[model samples]
Target: MSNETTTADGGVRKKGKLGQRIAYACGNLGQAAFYNAMSTYFIVYVTGCLFSGVDKALAAKLIGVITSLVVIIRIAEIFIDPLLGNLIDNTNTKWGRFRPWQFFGGLISAVLLAVIFSGMFGLVNVNTTLFIVLFVITFVVLDVFYSLRDISYWGMIPALSSDSHERSTYTALGSFTGSIGYNGITVVVIPIVSYFTWTLTGAKGEGQAGWTSFGIIVGLLGILTAWTVAFGTKESTNALRAKAQKNGNPLEAFKALFQNDQLLWVALSYLLYAIANVATTGVLLFLFKFVLDNQAAYSMTGVIALVSGLIMAPLYPILNKRIPRRVLYIVGMTSMIVAYILLGLFSTNMTVVFIALVLFYIPGTLIQMTAILSLTDSIEYGQLKNGKRNEAVTLSVRPMLDKIGGALSNGITGFIAVAAGMTGNATAADMTPSNIHTFEICAFYVPLILIVLSLLVFMFKVKIDEKMHAKIVKELEAKLASGEIVDDEAQTAETVEAIDEEAKTLTE
Candidate 1:
């Protein structure tokens, strides 16, 4: 027999099937694949392949200009992400606010990515100034669509489940699948970009034509993955949106999300972690080539990391039952710090390097998995505290920080490259001993410091531990079951007192 029930909002409520959860989570695979490709390889393409055959000195100058523009675009996202998030929250449609955007956004993103890699500007022999302007404009447009899909996509996590353990399950599955997609690109990108030949010349010459072809394929793959989520999972038809729709000021709703104390702490901690993580990955290619003396090792490292994550993914839900999130965070951060130090100290030893990479990733994945659950818990906290639910706006914190972190990572890596004289010299063969040292310091030590700082912030500032989360969930569920709307003033006062009590308990 089919199970169905009606919520107080007069909308149908039912648990999403396992198949739906798996399919919806699969969307992350494509999203992660596309994002990882761009963040990890796009700069490499611009600096190395795009300018192939051009004068090295001239190309280097142009690359500087491009990198600067890229950084600016990323900074622009800091403002853009929240606004897009607000728009998504305010949006209401028969098909749902998220799936439409996910479908169309992924579709447009594919086309734009293909266009970027198509080398059409080369065909037209566009002037350098005109090409840069057009490329920047195209990239911005592409990113806008990406944000649309991303914000809406992740927003669905809380909307998909109100239960904390369920959120952990979905997030863990998403992270696992997403890692597959991400590593798939990392492992094969080199071969894909060199598999075929065309009239193109320079670094790989006509072989670089494969980039455009690969872009097209990946683009289409993105669309397929998006559809899996769009068609599969069912979003909660909660009364929250109906209540939000009654108030038309999206800006107020957006502001209210940041005002949530728990969410604020979570976002800050996640932002720091994201910055350190992406920044370290940003410099790995350089480290592999110049320091490790094996470009292929970069892909191997990525594959091993992803495989480690896959093995560790199932363990998170099990561990969540036994460990407090605060303890988990501490353990993960401590493990990562130790791994980074070991990797730095024994940089030239292949066995140590491989072992360190594995050790780093296992706990890193655990931390990420737990962070997702914690963030979802904060959604309930916001609702209980603020008398409103803004899933899209609240969840947007992750993507917003992601963009900021990526931009900062790029800037950090770019500076290190320039300082080491690696920027002007494309190939690792030109790297001096001093350059290698600088690379090691920037890639390893800098990220270690950043992560250390992240741990401190999370440990002291973030207060939503397992006990606190349980309290919030119990109170919210009770409030829902009562079917009585408490007065705004009274609700706010009670929320404050309850949260304060939890804080006091945590301290005691």
Candidate 2:
């Protein structure tokens, strides 16, 4: 069956085959698994296992350095991501622009990630300097390649379909699968690491060998999903895209990106939300291990997240039909605020904690879906205003902001772990009231403040809604049909065909 579908407005749109859509969604499965493993637990592995054998003072110093290094590298990536996005935007090949990057970049990064998780094969205990050097190099390279894969994977969404509802379906599916990948790791990591660590070394808790094995598994999953996207999905091409490619200019694209007011507003709001959300989630492991004194209970949080994903992901499209995205965004943020407050007041109560998790996650998923749709729509807003489409560049903002958030979260998590004496052989029994207070301030209060700010920014500044987007689409379609925004290359090809037909008529 053909992948194309007819829209209500009589436009030919590529909705993609169900199989293709599923394949595209699978890209996020591996991506989230790989990313969450690193973003959420890499620090845990480093502080708890990798440096466990070192002297306490020296290990503390090294952890500080590593945390700062992670923050610096991710902050530096802020500059690199846009350039990579521009590169993806300009890329063209027989296999299409985004897939090659998604496949190869995912493959290489997944391997490097396993290397990172390996703790340099126990080199930290043998030669700390060499381990540090190799860690930095491997980490930087892994992040770059992963960003390329992430940017390209998301960038392809706009190309798949122009219909807003269809775009929401694609976004929802990807987000849902991504949730499964991320939370799936959360659910299984403790048990998996514990079992493997025991099997490999007769260790009592998580160890280097176990972490390494888990990393390798996640990496392989990443590779498989990347390949699925590359081979199973398709990119839709058109005159506008062809025209945009011909005149692609990175510098101009950057300028155009900033000029799109709607994009900037949505990006800024989402950035705030991402930083707060990630920072909170990133510290959950530390919370469970130290505050609650039940690291195994951490997996239940993931179970809650999975349930939230199942409900929220499918509900987004349905809710969106009846509610404005702006309103949903408000509701989600408000629910998170309430959850944080609940956690802050009664964190030691496992039942309250679990209930807060449910409240926080269900709405959090809705907010994420809303933000993604807003960002996707802003691409069209930029195109309508600038007369060029830079899907990769625009969508790159999502991952870029995410990295920045992850960077800050890593830094925050590292600092809190150290300050609260939660690192290296420390148990919840070791934590004092003071340590728990510090954790609460960073994990709960700080994020609460940020989420509130994010809500305010979106409510006041972001103007694009369903009605506005539909109007923009109508105007763009009218302009395209009237040749008011014609593709010069496509026009030239048409002119050549006309001339050839005229010559044949004269000969006849």
Candidates in order have lDDT scores of 0.74, 0.84
Question: Which residue pairs in candidate 2 collide?
Answer: none
lDDT of 1: 0.74
Q: Which stretches of candidate 2 lie over 4 Å from their true place?
A: 9-12, 486-508
User: Could you give candidate 1's per-residue lDDT for residues 315-353 as a string of tens digits?
Assistant: 777888798767888899999898899878987777788
Model 2, 220-337: lDDT tens digits are: 9999999999999889865345446743677866886887777888888999888888888998988787888888889999999988987888788888889977888999999999
Candidate 2 local lDDT, residue 389: 79
lDDT, model 2, position 72: 92
Query: Which one is best on TM-score?
Result: 2
Task: Give me the displacement of residue 8 in model 1, in angstroms.
Answer: 19
